[model samples]
Target: MFLWRALRSEGFPFVKKILLFALPTRLGGALGVQVILAALAPPGQAMLAEDFHRVLLSRALPAAVDGPDAAPAPEPLPSPGVPPTRLDELRKHVSKSALGMEIGPFHRPICPKREGFNCLTVDILPRDQLLQAYAEDKDVIPFQEHIEEVDVLLSSGLFASVAAYTQGQEARVQKAEGSLSYLISSHNFEHLPDPIAFLDDAATLLADGGFLTMAIPVGSRCFDCFRPLSTTGQLIDAHTSGRVKTTLGAIFDQSASAATHSGGQTIGDRNYDVAQVAVDACGGMIDESSFGALQFTHEFGHSGGIHSFVFNPYSFLLIIEDLQACGFLPLLRVQEVIDRPGQEFIVHIVKISEASRSPLPLDAARRTELLRQAIAYYIDDLNATRQLQNSP
Candidate 1:
């Protein structure tokens, strides 16, 4: 029984073929008679015959009967009620938690009925000018309400005043140092001609462990998507050279690719159309004639006041990391990045001055490598999402 099972398990046809061809002629008749007896056995005890029949039906018989061109059986459909697993890992990374309890004076109850914490809100215009602008536009009323609650409203336009508070300004730095627990800027970093200086100033003002929370527009979803991603090198150059105008290339790209959110749709959906008028008026080759005419308009003409930089999340994080390594933004750790549904991302950064060790500077080559890796990762994530959506 064991020998029969082994032969059958090892594929009987090959063994049978070898035996039939290799057996001595004298023993051939004996083997053939045994095979006949096995085949003629009673059905109840005919296990070897049953096994042989099954092998023939499962292997050689089907192909012989159906021919070589038969189609394969259809695959089973995925079971219903089984949740899609594609985005589970991604959603975990993007989900928000309630603001951390350890955020020092900036801890929530961000808006208090009566002021309890010392906070500084930085803006280009002073309080009265901001109010006047608000008065002209009813849409600004909501912002005005929040501005009214601020303890100190600092104007960046007053260069001398800001210089007083920033590091290296001995007299003013001492007075303001570690005094402010919270500093909030909204939609302002992109307007700064020198973001490094602004960051240094904020770091100088913030108390040890204080929080700096800011909301910045995601460049790809904004009008600036047409513009190229700005690099730390570009920022360093602007800071060092005192360039007052956004490059002409940036201006032309912005104008040429200006887009607005489509009706009843979010920017994430890529439901947008070009603003043709903007292109007609502002987009053109920067030849001598056109350069002279368009030079002082749109982004370049506005004293670099338009979105001076463009960033997606990866690029933005890379800039922040490089800035910290360069010592332009020391001891600042990014605590959280919260994605807003249709608009911008909010970043919470904490100044961790308690640590005894200082941060090391990241070299230019390493910074570039890190930025490249981040961009590649983001691209891979986007490609994966697209592939998942297209799969059957």
Candidate 2:
């Protein structure tokens, strides 16, 4: 102990400063210096404070080797319920997964709430308009490589913007067949320069097995003439049928409807009924025999402030059956009906493949299930809209 104390006293070369500044007293300073020096200068060489004694004697040094006993490993994450190989199913799964991730950590995805309207909202909107937007914005995902041309992008007057776009692509003409691609102008189909003749030309222009997609309103009839009135307006009266009344009111404000008929094609006191006109505008480019697939999207409320109407989901189903009866088969699939946040639609996607087959036979039970889901989806969406509306 005496030798240890002596050696420790010599450790820090600055003993006087340590005593004056660090320790406050000469004796205590010397004591600290001796202690530190004793701890550091080999175990036996010790002096001064108890702090120094503990430092030298402690055996807390870490070892490099792992001990024989170790905690068990954690379990792995489970595999996804869905298989990722099928394109349609895979797309659905990926979209759902990506959407789930976008929400904040605390919230889980609840079924989308419905807005007050006629039809359950669809995932796809303003179908042709949306397509054109994607095309104009360079946002389309070209699934097949070397698309010589888009087969046929059929449309109604609503897609007039797309028609003008096709006309502008004249440079790609010759093989372009651009005009054939723009078989639009549904409201004015009857007045087209040579309506029948134009359609004939379009038919001759389309290649075999080409696909034509259009977004035309589907219902008992299409009232072309404007009936410009708010849904709650007074011009609507006792004698007018709800369908015609809504059509006339929503499509036109009094001034626009008053304009002279552009030909027989003008929306007058006449009615263009059902979706057949949109299909018919294709000339023979598409018919029951060549009809590929049909997707019906319904939205109750729209930009024009039309009163909401129930989407006849049954009507669409009937159409599908009619197509099959007409010889086209393989309805193959039906998507989970969705109700968008503020719109009304039950959009259907029908893919026609020679080898395609319907997932299950259409029957009472299935139809009931579809109706239940659609209504439930809309109810939820309506609640959501109310919440959003009430929110500050």
lDDT of 2 by residue, 68-105 (tens): 21111112212322222222221232222111110100
Error of 2 at 99 (Å): 29
Candidate 1 C-alpha lDDT tens digits along 162-247: 44435442332335555555555556677666777766666665656556666677665556644567888878987788654456
lDDT to native, each model: 0.47, 0.26
TM-score of model 2 (CA atoms): 0.24
* Model 1 pairs in collision: none
Query: TM-scores of all models?
Result: 0.54, 0.24
Off by over 4 Å in 1: 1-117, 141-174, 243-253, 261-294, 297-305, 361-392
RMSD of 1: 23.9
